[model samples]
Target: MEENIYNNTYSLLKLIREKKPLVHHITNYVTINDCANIVLAIGASPIMADAVEEVEEIVSLASALVINMGTLSKEHVEAMLVAGKKANELGIPVILDPVGVGATAFRKKGAEKIIKEVKLAVIRGNMSEIKSISGISVKSKGIDASERDIIQNDNLEYGKDISEELALKLNCVIAITGVVDIISGEGKTVFIDKGHKMLSTVTGTGCMCTSLIGAYCAVSRSYFEAAIAGILTMDLAGEKAYKNLKTIDEGSGSFKMKLMDSIFNFNHLLKNIILR
Candidate 1:
């Protein structure tokens, strides 16, 4: 609702393209490629290396680190710890995407362990995923947010309260991407309701969003603003991508490509879009 929440956001996008910082990722393999390209699309370089044997070395050269538990394993979590710890030691912000964290004990345990061990700059997930991490899960649908758990206009205020509480408790930004993305941290809550519903139909959109956040983290002055910038980019990109499909009736495949194109040309498309 504030002007800085929108008007000042364009500067962050431009800064990312100008700085071109390297982002390190220990993300899931399912959307690893998508995450890398999306970071590149937003004008930051991506260096994805999850091997525990060399994560410390790799993270030393990165400006930001993204840890996604979308596809987790013992070895992957081990590497995440290595890379995450190194990122913290170097003062490199780390962003976590707790994908499917509510679906299984394994993923949940892995996410909790990472949270405890590494000080994250941002934790990006949907309602169910974020609620689960905060010790409250309103049923999850695999990796998706439960319909019953989504934050609608009627529950928007309540959603902001809980998300802010979680951000305070965790000492990091809480980013929940959904019908209306809510970002809360440092006693601030910024909501960006710019995305299309068709975004949920595509796979790895959340992962890509986290990666975009990581890229912004690399260059932005505030993590809260960086989260807003990253999520706003994806949400606005989704709107543009879906608008392109309305005339032809294409599906997710076409939508995916167009989404990337929108991000690739984000500087032009993102101008003057008002925020809620």
Candidate 2:
């Protein structure tokens, strides 16, 4: 099974590089550039278009669509609906990143609306955000997840149960990312425990993960496998980025650049450390 996963991951990586799938993103402005760069680093082209007028047309041409609610706005929400529906109609995969869903009622409502109206292939978020959408009580601090909400060794089983429940309810893959990332869908679950702590220091890492998922889903038919490949790619690149950092202060700055470089140079060797 592990070898099959490795082979699948390698094949997906090669397919993305060869196909260069176009990913359409209706994402937050805060991490827009990082999202685009990450998509390119993963061997996919990115188009960040949230204009309601052009979103439907853009998504029609894209191989996949990613919707993020980090910086929510009325106009952007409408754009997401437009693009997501068009993607669904065209049979293109869609990935959603409900960033900071528990931080504000506006974000929560917007995310809910998107989920209700669109058929998402995957939903990716931090523990707090996932819990919020899942109706599991959780507290969030602005955009960052509360320390108390962090998934730890003791609550691994609890986390898995909640994630699986949410996945079954939503009828889509749910990825709750933290110290140990949990991905649940199709009545099965996966835990990825290979990322470095320095990953939290960089802004837009989560958004980049969503974009990477979009890239993977564009070429792969299975949302579960696409999500696993995406999270593993981010985690493995994060580990390499932290290792390449020279100074302590350079953690965020250097790590950001190295993360992209690592993704660009990703190979089968990096897949060995990814825990299932």
Q: Using TM-score, give the best candidate's number.
A: 1
Per-residue CA lDDT of model 1 for 19-74, tens digit only, reads 89999999888899999999999999999898899999999999999999988899
For model 2, residues 1-276, the per-residue Cα lDDT tens digits are 656666677889889999999999998888999999999988999999999999999998899999999888999999999889999999998899998888888988898899999999999988888889988777788888889778777788988988999899989999988999899998889888779988898889999999999999999988898999999889988988888888767857888899999998886445554443
Judge candidate 2 at residue 240 and give its lDDT.
Answer: 85
Residue pairs clashing, model 2: none
- The per-prediction tally of clashing pairs is 0, 0
Tell me model 1's lDDT, rounded to 2 decimals.
Answer: 0.89
Clashes by residue pair, model 1: none
What is the alpha-carbon lDDT of model 2 when measured against the actual structure?
Answer: 0.88
How high a TM-score does candidate 2 get? 0.95
Global lDDT scores for all candidate models: 0.89, 0.88
For model 1, the stretches where C-alpha displacement exceeds 4 angstroms are 272-276
